[model samples]
Target: MATFAEPLRPNVASADVQLPGVRDYEQVDTEIIGTLKPTAGWFGALGVAIAMFLVGAAAWIYQIYWGLGNAGYAPPVMWGVYIITFVFWVGIGHAGTLISAILFLFRAGFRTTIYRCAEAMTVFAVMTAGLFPIIHIGRPWKFFWLIPYPNWRLIWPNFKSPLVWDVFAISTYLTVSSTFLYVGLIPDIAVLRDRETNPLRKRILAILSLGWRNSEPEWRHFMKMYLFLAAFSTPLVLSVHSVVSFDFAMALTPGWHATIFPPYFVAGAIFSGIGMVFTIIIPIRKFFKLQHYVTINHLDAAAKLALFTSMVVGCAYLIEFWVAWYSGVAAEQDYFWNRVFGEWWWAAWIMLTCNMIFPLSLFSQKLRRNPTWLFILSIFINIGMWFERFVIIVPSLSHEFEPWQWGHYVPSWVDMSILVGSFGWFFMWFLLFIKQLPVVAIAEVKEIVPPKLRSHARGHGLDPSGHHLPYGTETPGEFD
Candidate 1:
């Protein structure tokens, strides 16, 4: 392995420089793989995550024992924090596929450093999102009824319900996203396997790596399949969120009925997902000392994307009010009015400020390039996105057409515990993931590194191909 005298440093320049701050193949390996090593902080984080998850699990058990009524189920606002959180997690999961698949297809260079962790976030967020439907249904065990199973009674899920569509959408997203994530990990795991001295660990990695030898045939097959998956997964970025939106747009309720919802939800999902990517990667870059790989240039590019989505989301908000007023439907206009100034006005304003107002700061070039500011902005965006969902779901359900049915919802201790637990659940998986596997893609990182850095002979690096591959060569690409 080729070694550099200096450790990798964060790149503060424009992302126009391809794979900025990365040098030899071994530097990528050394820095990214180093994150897998155990530290006191890692243990401490894991302990906190475990405790949070256990508390959430306990809250869930209590909910199950006491029934769904134990949640903050006000009459008109039957859907509360659980449904809001479900949508939030689903939205959070969107950026991963967008970064990994859509950005890959577009050949975006900035994605090279950050896409691995983003993809992981997608899978875990979806996993966390999946739990809410079962919890909300009040019967966790019989959740299989949502599936199209061939039972003796011949009962099947309602094809008309958007809730049923969610089952298909979330499941398909999870299946494809999980497969894509694991496929990308094979080569990286092979690197870990070859370097392992522990017999048991080596054996486990060997199995996970699926005999990845980086040979010519393997690279050919790998690149072809990767391209295919990227193409296949690209449509999913648009479709999954659109389907989630249908849950609202298809409804007859005053605030819920809107044609703009599909695109509106899609944009919001991307915005939130990117916000989460910043939240996760900034810390990983700082703590794991992976600044060179996940540089300021990369984050600046991401901030730009977030800014673009923020505009789209802000526009959607304006369009919602415009359509309601323009249509002149009393119920529709009333619902819109109540959403902004009624019982949950504070939540609505927070959503507006966080999602629309705060993100405006990213338009400044300096803050876009500053990791600290970007991190702080990303936190606000996530919080705003959460409130965005809360405002959307709760207000609409609470203030429906009939005045007699109106009611205000307040989340119980159970609701709050479960909500907090969901974060714990998400972080627990993410923490375990970073510790066990390479958080950055080794093969993909090598693919994007500048040609000047590709000085090694075939045997000197992770590539099993006979010779060093150039930047543009498709054959024996990462390995050759």
Candidate 2:
């Protein structure tokens, strides 16, 4: 028995050679770049994003110049928007890594184009997410004290603390996520490097590509490295979020303490992350004309994941209620009751509607297939997920055991600005990424689209192949 070699299509070198008018690679490239370039609307969006960022920046500056007193983080509400946004952004980062790393490990073909953008979102969102802890500290300058470094001062971070655990977990997550994102982007960067005519662009891409020459050996090594990174990333996805959940579970707070927090938080993270992906990608696909690559099929698949995770999240919610009542813990029962019928009843209802009811519509295949509906549903899910985080963080902290500390907490302008600004920061990096990188992985797209599908237009006399050939005409033996 003879082993068959993998199919060989055109590499980056052959990509430059045009097949006459059959496919205007230049036009396609132009369209791709054009979609990425900031248009008038993008500029407006950028301005809003920048303004929000500056507002958050100015708030942090004031916090640094003065103290944490400016941010409304009093004794009771010590963990305010900072921790809330931290968890929120961390949750937002979940779907990207899970989709890219885990799905890739399972050889999910739909991830080819979606994963690149999703991974980019993961890295940037995590970066933004990591900032909250630094800003949340009263003395922001002493942020590094969280690290257990050998120092002349003979000071060490408390390893037993959940906050310290968070530092380790988040840092590890950021490092691993960034590594995965950069590794996956190298091949695409090489393609850009080859196509780039400008010296500066070429030089930058070349360095980013790490001297990749697009050789068979290079591609082979790249694949192995990427696979290893993906494998490494999969566990980090589970562990990092689990560690985050521990921050709450290990606490003595009635609603916060629970063994189920890990899986529950992870599911909510993935749920929110998918919502964010859809929110970003839907508009991008339309504006960029990436319909072929980011088709309804991709959206449908994402919707399915979103719906599945939503169900998991819903189950978690139900279990939390059941456990609180069944445990016979008076405080826990009151806390759970207070969550639903208490002052924060509105937040609980919002969570139930967004996480459970809204996503339930996706059971209808038509709703999931419709892009407009998908976008609407995604927005609702995002809002609901945010509410879920807010509900988890605020009510538990606001209404603790002590009657004096059982005061209601409301976000000030500073808190609201910072929260909204985080969205701006996320979108800013994401928009910049779309402009710089090939939003669609061209090589991967070519790999996935069947050889027969490639030449269908040619057979219909719509392509410039001249001869009415069957599929795989231009590259006959190559595809085989």
Backbone clashes, each candidate: 0, 0
Best by lDDT: 1
Candidate 2 structure lDDT? 0.79
Record all residue pairs in model 2 with backbone atoms less than 3 Å apart, i.e. clashing.
Answer: none
RMSD, one per candidate, in order = 7.0, 7.7
**Candidate 1 accuracy as TM-score:** 0.91
Writing each residue's lDDT as its tens digit, candidate 2 over 263-338 gives 9999999999999999889898887777765755567667888989999999999999999999998888888899
TM-score of each: 0.91, 0.88
In terms of TM-score, how similar is model 2 to the real structure? 0.88
* Candidate 2 colliding pairs, count: 0
The worst-scoring run of ten residues by lDDT in candidate 1 lies at 471-480
Residue 249 C-alpha lDDT in model 2: 93
Positional deviation of residue 420's Cα in model 1 after best superposition, in angstroms: 0.5
